[model samples]
Target: MNNRLKSVISAAAIAVGLCFAPVQAADLPHVVILATGGTIAGTGATSTTTVGYTAAKLGVDKMIESVPELQKVAEVRGEQVAQIASESMTNEVWLKLAKRINQLLAQKDVDGIVVTHGTDTIEETAYFLDLVVKSKKPVVVVGSMRPSTAISADGPINLYNAVILAGSKEAVGKGVLVALNDQINAAREVTKSNTSTADTFRTPELGFLGYMQDNKAHFYRMSTRKNTADTEFDVSKLSSLPRVDIVYGYANMDRVAMDADIGAGAQGIVQAGVGDGSVAAQMMPAFRDARQKGVIVVRSSRVGNGIVARNGEANDDKEDFVVSDTLNAQKARILLMLALTKTHDTQAIQRMFYTY
Candidate 1:
């Protein structure tokens, strides 16, 4: 054939190939994994070395590459949001993360989100996102007690389950979720109950939201509390959150820590008190003084489980203090921080403690 004829035939063939090219896969949900440094991305000296490992050593891309089965679960992608231990999770990172998630969930193309966080503060981050993310799409926060390089590391499976849960229709409107040890836990109720175990995160009283059984998500219960799009929290415009501190109440407790926190410009304080969130008599003066200075006070417990009922042990009404209800000290701090952003009135903040 002549050169001109051959060129025309090649062009036609290329056009045919273009027409037959596979369209983008629409069956799988597009799930984004946002990695904040935790044990899920940690590295150990050997496969059997679970502890004494370096956390946040691996990046998000490395984690995504480690789990090949995730390809079948969703249209997966990753972003390294931060590289720090969860114990060191800062308010700045929390605001940044919540803002990013809200922005992503607002997009029509993004179907779900998975956050890889340190187990220490995984519940905190999850609850924080649960209250701030303004979408019904699934937002699962996952972490492994074992490092990725440990023997029988749980990161891969946990991550796989997280992606699966995030992409599931059943997970929508379930509030933020925590997926680990083949279980799905609501962000508000789940807490790390063990120090070195795969099944550490648990809902001590309320129970699991569901499980990742048969390689799929099976939900039996849903959180009744306000969350996600239901909350009025908007962190998109704020650069910082109010400083909230926690004080542990014990025998012969003093007011040094309380005074220091107040002096440090704390806007609110959560007292992780004994049995029923009792405040030490010695510390009451400081707490009252803090309240006088327009600082909000919340009564929470160190007992791990049970409600810190209003007026049960402490005269919350007379003290002009707020009760944390079922919220633990750390969580109370989180709610109080967000609450102070709106109103400083103890009555208003107390109402928030009940609602959120």
Candidate 2:
């Protein structure tokens, strides 16, 4: 055949291939459901048995099967990442989930990913994944207040909302989010506020980032900073991290707790300080001494809301501590622990606090 004739045949073949390739659904977006056992997968005898239930009873497939409405929003696929309560989740589980999210995001057919997690440590996992997974696609973490067997179970609806949020164009590149009780929250700011309430999870200071309504997700605000997907830190490069301790500050507090953590070989310490992030005077010398010995000290207030002030504290400033800006103490501890994996520089740590 002539060169021109050959080119015409090749173009025709390419056109045919393009036409036959799989297409995303207009009614349903392609979604990957990564199920790590939580309340959503738990089973109980009675409605009030929220805490005393047997967890991990329902696997990802069973959970999806129970909530068939998820099919209306996305083409869903399930992977059982772990079958344990959220309390049992560890750094290993976080690494495993991050790796899987990375793998799924690489696929052309996948539009988003949903993680079903236990409420106890859902925020920690969400925050961990938020800092690690590098994907522009929506990654949503969701859980339930009631078990599947309960009369007023909230899992099915929460799962459906998560699917809607995951598939929506608005959710892409907003970092990892937690969709619960019809509210959309950034993973970095969301926390489980109540043990048994349907409206348990919330982002206290910033409020809900968005919400799912009318089978669609509507965004009221946009996350301004770069997160897991856009940062220089590589998720796959991390292994096990050093031990970190969170010490709560209170009135007339003794320095024994701080010294205990230091003596226990804690590589990092998070002080859940009193109001406005102030530590008791007695604990100041111990904190300063810990910093002198090369331990990382981060200051976060025990109060549920507001930023920790960096100025006007003699011992706090002397320790070269990084202040938690509007993040609750527990969440701040998670961020500091993860940040320590990369660097110990106080400036870099403070920059991370501001950005994320």
Which pairs of residues collide in candidate 1? Answer: 47-151
Candidate 1's residue-wise lDDT over 254-296, tens digit each?
Answer: 9899889989999998999999998877888898899899888
How well is each residue in 1-356 modelled by candidate 2, as lDDT tens digits?
99999999999999999899755455468899999998889999887676688877899999899987777678998999999999998878888899989998999889999999988999889888888888889999999888888887889999999988888898988999999888888888888887778898887767889888888888898666668777656658667766788999887888888788889988888888878888677887888898888888888888788777776444445568788877777777777777888898888988888887
In the order shown, the candidates' Cα RMSDs to the true structure are 6.2, 6.2
Clashing residue pairs found in predicted model 2: 134-229
Best by lDDT: 1
TM-score of each predicted structure versus truth:
0.93, 0.89
Q: Which stretches of candidate 2 lie over 4 Å from their true place?
A: 1-27, 314-316
What's the distance in Å from true for residue 258, model 1? Answer: 0.4
TM-score of 2: 0.89
